[model samples]
Target: MRNLLILGAMAFCLCVHVCSDTQSGPQGDTTLPEEDGVLQLKQEHFKRALRKYKQLLVHFCKLHSDLSFKDAAEALMGSEVKLGVVDVTQEKDLVKELNGTSYPMVRLYISGDIHNPVPCPGVKTVLSDRISYFCTNLHRLSHLCFFVQELTNAYSQVFHAAAVDLPDISFALTQNEEVSRKYRLSQDVVLLLRKKLDCRKHFKTSQILSSPVLNHALLFVNKSSADFEEISSAFSSAAENFRMKILFVLVNVAESRNGRLMEYFRVRDFEAPLIRLVNLTDHVTYHLPSDTLNVEVIQEFCQSYLDGKAKPKMQSEPIPEGWDQKPVKELVGMNLEQVAFNPDKTVFVLFYLPYSKASRTLFPLWEELAEAFRQREDVVIARIDASANDINLSTQGAYPSLCLFPALYTERSHIYIWRKKYLKTEN
Candidate 1:
């Protein structure tokens, strides 16, 4: 596994390097013509040519292998709008002049206004669909989409499409008066959106239950906000030591309103301020022997888990008949797209084998989520047996897989798959 990951990383780097070199330099025999749509801009010809286009869309990318870069370039091939590709590595001075710090950066130049360039808003990665959406509606909206206000029909459609297409990205609305005043928001509203990391700090009950990180949840369960803050601070300080190797989360036992997880971990109500490290992969756990939770102790606990010296503990959860209820609809090939691509709702689908012990064990958790969100009108939770259904869904190598299909306007709907590792053992 380690070798495969290393090889994958190396291959990715090589692809990036080769692509960067090709785009930065000249194509061997087949050079793209200016009319081909994407213009290759350099330090020398950057300024003069940019001013010529009435509306210009420029993509500053360091690598040719950047999927978003390629996607955006293809989306604008036959359009009247001009697309420019700048290889940042070869044009360091030009990138500096444009004040670009991130690679695969995209900006729009309109009406020969080189002084104030309009940046694609709420964009962290170069998504072709998102870039095209933003550019087509650039004139009607603000230069940056982050400004809070009423979203135009086109803008809303694009924003929601991007959110559905990219599961890691979350779109949030902030209506705080103070925040609006502080930011001087034009529309008295702020659209907060960003790509979420897999190892983000806090985990709500719904997220924890649905997350693959349930296999290895280093939970700091606490009753008081003060204790939660203290333990979270300590974990944050020690988190860098583990990086992506482990997931650290804070579970406020009292606030989350989810008692099943506490029961699964056998955390008593009296044990409010406690730290427990669960290894769902092995069905074992390690509890902090001491009451004092600090950065040093947390680091030591993590080190012990890595060293495989942590003692095993049994998980306890009461199995009820209601737990066996099927809230997740079984999806077949014929109805898969019909149900998944419903324009009114976002669908979360789980793919699993009926006979697999691991699948059976996790089914209750998914049911619990379905029951919890049963009242929601905008979401649908469903499951499909992979053996029975031959449809291609992103599994990320896990048997019992979960994927989210968002309802967006596109020829093909994007599926967001949960790629976290799952336990294969029956134990």
Candidate 2:
């Protein structure tokens, strides 16, 4: 079933195509024409569009198998926003220049500045949801508050409130006709207030355990629907109050579907109505007190967890086989930070396509470098298969690209020193 789902998703991605109106250019030149809707961006028009629009959302994807790109473009179609898509396969130079080795990468360019772009959250199927939420909440939170009065006056008041930082809230007036029609707004005008931090109540094993977001995950493990409902209600109330400070997740241990996670968390058969707070960053767990669950107790639990008073029970995962035995450390999404950002050591990472001739050709060079640096305590060498790792290699400019990363302990922040010496060789 899992394999079938994976294949289905792959099929969906394979069907994505460049817009029909997209114009092709010479070998190195890609042209992007001015279009009102989603602009099919090429190398030539990428930077120009960023400079023209105050807020631009660019989707870097291949011509095929890019379902996320299509979904994001469709969701933001009617909004007064500039949306663009880049076919990474067609413009390899541009992709390399931007360090965009990951498929279906989304970036937000604000105020024509290209040096630092905010990465769009969520991946694969959830891309559209995250993009919609971000678009709705960009700059400040937006709410669709209805007010039956002069439209201009309401907008002015909201603008003034946002400008003066009053009410500790930001506001925007969306008078776009298309947006109004899409949302079915019958009134002449409405105030859009920002929403509170959107929290995930029901979590799957994949999302909760793998997400990089650092938060105290309060999991309510219950069997009965009545117990689940009561605890969920209390959790929702507390979650809104704490909003963004913690994550509340509900797990039905009774369901066979969640059996694996239950076992992983070590929830005994008798511990159905139990609650566990997990801190993924530190790999710590805290069990709830034996007393009945309530809003007050849950709040106290969160407060105590935040205050670092709760005793931490360690959670461990068996290291992958041959992890520490490799000379060129294989980089994955989970271990990227632990290796790349080591405070005591400088890391030299090679980003390459595993099967490519160029990558194979450079393997010996990297191995030799790793061997030379093996005894150096302050320096580490690593290599990442660009195809296997979906992480953003922000400084990588080409396949088999070498990037020297400074130690985190250095006063200067992480900087990528790109090496083009090896890339000059023919594949």
Candidate 3:
């Protein structure tokens, strides 16, 4: 009972807090302090606070400006969250360190992301609305860090390694009875403090809107499905090991409240018991091919992802048979990177629509251009069906476009050299 109560508090804690952090940079030695539940933080305080707090919300404001968020900050800060304010006007150095040139900015620094703070928006809204807005951002939940306290250790080195790898999760093993009394746990059993995100209640409209950019893993299930409990248990167990690396969520396809999320993921009701993982940074989504959702299988799927064994869904068509048989090699999505963008070879590509008259007129000219470079093993000429595939470059999206990826080209800073003089079209 005591353990259960404590878990409840931790769950409630998740709904009130958010993130912030700064590295241990050289600063003047001064004892900064916390008063009225808000830390009067300086440049040096962030390093200390980074080690102390799991979730932090920092408000950067001009001291003389309107103190509109004072009450909202107080209401948001609790045992779960530590609130701090920086006087941007006075601490010009701190402002620069935080990469800020403006006042009245709110940034949340979570445990893992110390160098980059997540910008907290909707600060200028009403006090009630501000709290409401903060509550709905699924990322800012009841408690930032989860704690599992018991006498017997229920987990092994896998859990320990995970804790070390992801400092965002707080795990503790204690043989203390007093801890349970607070939460009312009486028996000696394996109890893990955890929070599960059910799409019906956890995912708000804003959260749904931001799903593409979020590191999200979702299990879509049906209430009437016979394997629902087994799958749910396995998914939750898998989620424990991933902590800050992934935001694991579940959705009931049968519930109308979850319909919007289902549509967003393009999940049909007939496709219950499905699992998918999405990368937040790259916006890539991977689907699990198996229908079985067991502990071993789910963990393997997650482990494979962490090991980079899974492939993301990219826009590409199948490579045609003997793609390089012609003078101008025909390229597809699969071979585009290795052939057209080869670092050792200077490459040129013609992106054309086969059906376009203008595209047809360039075929003979393209063949001549390819023949010119055919003898040079250091250079290659290629043509792709642009209308049938995506080149992933903004400027190369249009049909009848020409591009050059020289030997000096880079993945981050790629350029296209389009030659517009060879304009021949069948009128």
Candidate 4:
């Protein structure tokens, strides 16, 4: 885990302990004193908030620390600037509340005793990003709380570290129109970084886009409804970025209605090898603002996306040669020493038991060749009864079939023999 600088902590601690700190570097460190009866924030607490704000702070506050925002905003009745935590454990109720409130409700909506959903989005985010976003938009607490709760859990898995909890930090939300617009922009950026990407694992800008074996690129859009033709043209250069095989997986956070647009743009149903689509919402869109992103959820989301579920296969055939062997080694252990003795010409030997039905048929034919070829100098033949030994082989498919290379054993020069007659077609 990386070390994070709290509101006002030693600068060195934040730098040296950045094991999981995604947002690196030091930004401006500013603070204001408690002049009036309003709550006075400690320097340590303020630094933590500053770091979070600079790195993950989506909105910029025009009113500096000395501007006295709380007193001024309260005086303006039509202001859109808001600062506070919004609890959205009751998701529908919270939305209803926001519908009536003024624009830019800077509430940090926390999950307050609400019904959970499937694949509960794990927490994988670092502490700084979550708190920075949380504190900055405290006025929209309900939106923040609802979204944060889910994102926090999801991010927890990615950072694999604890967030510096700011239980004491307070924010002031107002109805300032300019502040609201700025906050919206900042929120969009935060969502882009937090939701669309697994910042801990994804390739950075340093990685080369064009290569012979594999090529990769990242495409993002403001909304899911962005035109497909525009996107295709925008990324056209990337299509020619590789030589051999190019694989593209588009990741986006869009409205559910845009699902069809994504499917059409990516040609998802055809399952083309060159392009793919992944919806970030499929993982944690339902999360409220206050919900923390944790590492566990990050791991599960990553694992599920990277490792697709295995499906059951229906039986296609009855019995085939080499199907009975549980493992290839079981069939290779038999009569190995005897097969090694033939060095003049290549000896194609099979190791199988006579009792197995597939082996029973293959062993007799092999025996006839062994007898005929024993006196010949050009070829040698042999068989091993795997059943006689303790080796296990799978009987689900083909069995007793000659393998090309069985465990690369030194017992025989080759596992399968081919006659010159087979080579006449190659020339």
Off by over 4 Å in 2: 1-52, 57-81, 87-148, 152-213, 254-260, 268-270, 314-427
Candidates 1 and 4 compared by lDDT, better number: 1
Give residue 209's error in model 2 in angstroms.
6.1
lDDT by residue (tens digit), candidate 3, 1-427? 9999999998777654421112222233334576656677787666777666766777888765455446666776543456778888677887877677456787767773667666665344423443233322112223322223432255433444444334333443433545545556665433455666442346555555455436678898997888888788888878777766677788789999888777656679998889888765554567787978887887788788879998765457799898887778889877888886678888878888889877787899899998988888888888888665655554433457776777867353344433465433221
| Prediction 4 global C-alpha lDDT | 0.33
Q: Which segments of candidate 3 are over 4 A away from where they belong?
A: 1-202, 208-213, 220-226, 251-273, 289-291, 307-316, 321-329, 341-345, 349-379, 383-427
C-alpha lDDT of all candidate models, in order: 0.61, 0.62, 0.66, 0.33
User: Model 1, range 307-386, lDDT digits (tens) per residue?
Assistant: 98765442322223343245666666556767788877888777777897767777888889999988887788887776
Error of 4 at 384 (Å): 4.5
Of candidate 2, the 10-residue stretch with the lowest lDDT total is: 132-141
Top model by lDDT, which number?
A: 3
Work out the TM-score per prediction: 0.31, 0.41, 0.39, 0.21
Worst 10 residues of 4 by lDDT: 113-122
- Candidate 2's residue-wise lDDT over 315-386, tens digit each? 333335676577777766557667777888898777777787877877898899989888887887887766
User: Which tens-of-lDDT digit does each residue in 93-186 have in candidate 4?
Assistant: 5434233223222322122211111110111121224344324433442322212333345543332222223322332223334544645643
Model 4 misplaced stretches (Cα beyond 4 Å): 1-190, 194-343, 351-356, 384-397, 403-427
Q: After superposition, how far is residue 47 of candidate 2 from its true place, in Å?
A: 7.7
Q: Clashing pairs in model 1? A: 148-189
- For candidate 1, give the lDDT: 0.61
